[model samples]
Target: MIEVLGENFIIQQIRDFEDSQFEQTFSGIDKATSNIKNIFESLANKSCKIVRYKKFKQKILNRKPWVDHEVRDLKKTIKPKGAKLRQEPFNLELKCNFFTHAEKL
Candidate 1:
């Protein structure tokens, strides 16, 4: 039988049929807890790295404001031929279209 309470409490009712029953159950629970701890630690580390990188990128962007203007000018100057491409404000769509067309061959 399993009993769950609130958001995190889980109680399993195990009838002892042999001497090894309690040891097996507790061992399994210990292994599961260890695995969960490892996963949480890894995810936390990855998220911290992502946040650090974002902060670093924001600092760099702040230092070089003209970089954005140059990129915008470069996008306006480049255009694909043979397709009636609508004027997209961002270059992402155009880049994706270029890659898709290249993949067809």
Candidate 2:
């Protein structure tokens, strides 16, 4: 699984910080300076989570051998174009075409 911070949750966290007056913690500091410091601390802290996602290794492993080989070849073709096909967003029709092509191969 690939893990990364969730941007949406982070934004919500910032909103919560504003709502909760979390910045009040540094009230002793100069108002302008404290606001800047609070902003920095909010971004730097563990208020965010590491989101996990399944990497393509599991997907390829779960497929039939021939289908997996076709996937690998498709990956090779996209490699020259700078990314894996699996990383691209696919709509229903495109996904159907991909599976159809894999089954044909």
Candidate 3:
């Protein structure tokens, strides 16, 4: 009877150790998953910024001709009023509608 009790105690101890190890492993995996999620989020933000800059640049380039014409018209209109003619490069606002729509993911 004593030998049977000793064997049962050893079996219980081994089961407990296995359960502890499994819990530790699962916790480590959760931490790794969280870290990966953060890294991906940072990467997504960088990509969005790059795309926004590219689109802003393209729009400015497209408007070059219209901007020149508008400036010429403005100068002609203001010349009779004795106003000084001035021209400057304007920064265009690039709306991230697509990025905002996809933010849910």
Task: Estimate every model's Cα lDDT from 0 to 1.
Answer: 0.45, 0.54, 0.45
Better of 1 and 2 by lDDT: 2
Error of 2 at 55 (Å): 36
The C-alpha TM-scores of every prediction are 0.24, 0.20, 0.24
Query: Which model scores highest in lDDT?
Result: 2
Q: How close is candidate 2 to the true structure, as a TM-score?
A: 0.20
Q: C-alpha displacement of 67 in model 1, angstroms? A: 57
Candidate 1 segments whose C-alpha is farther than 4 A from its true place: 1-24, 49-105
Model 3 residue runs over 4 Å out of place are 1-24, 49-105
Tens-digit lDDT track of model 3 for 1-105: 334334554446445544543335878778656655654454455444454343443345444555677566665554433322123223221123223323422
C-alpha positional error of residue 24 in candidate 3 after TM-score superposition, expressed in Å: 6.3
Model 1: clashing residue pairs?
A: none
Q: Candidate 1 residues 1-105, lDDT tens each?
A: 111221132111111212222335878778656655654554455444454343444345343565666565544444452243455535676767655655543
Alpha-carbon RMSD to native, per candidate: 15.1, 17.2, 22.2
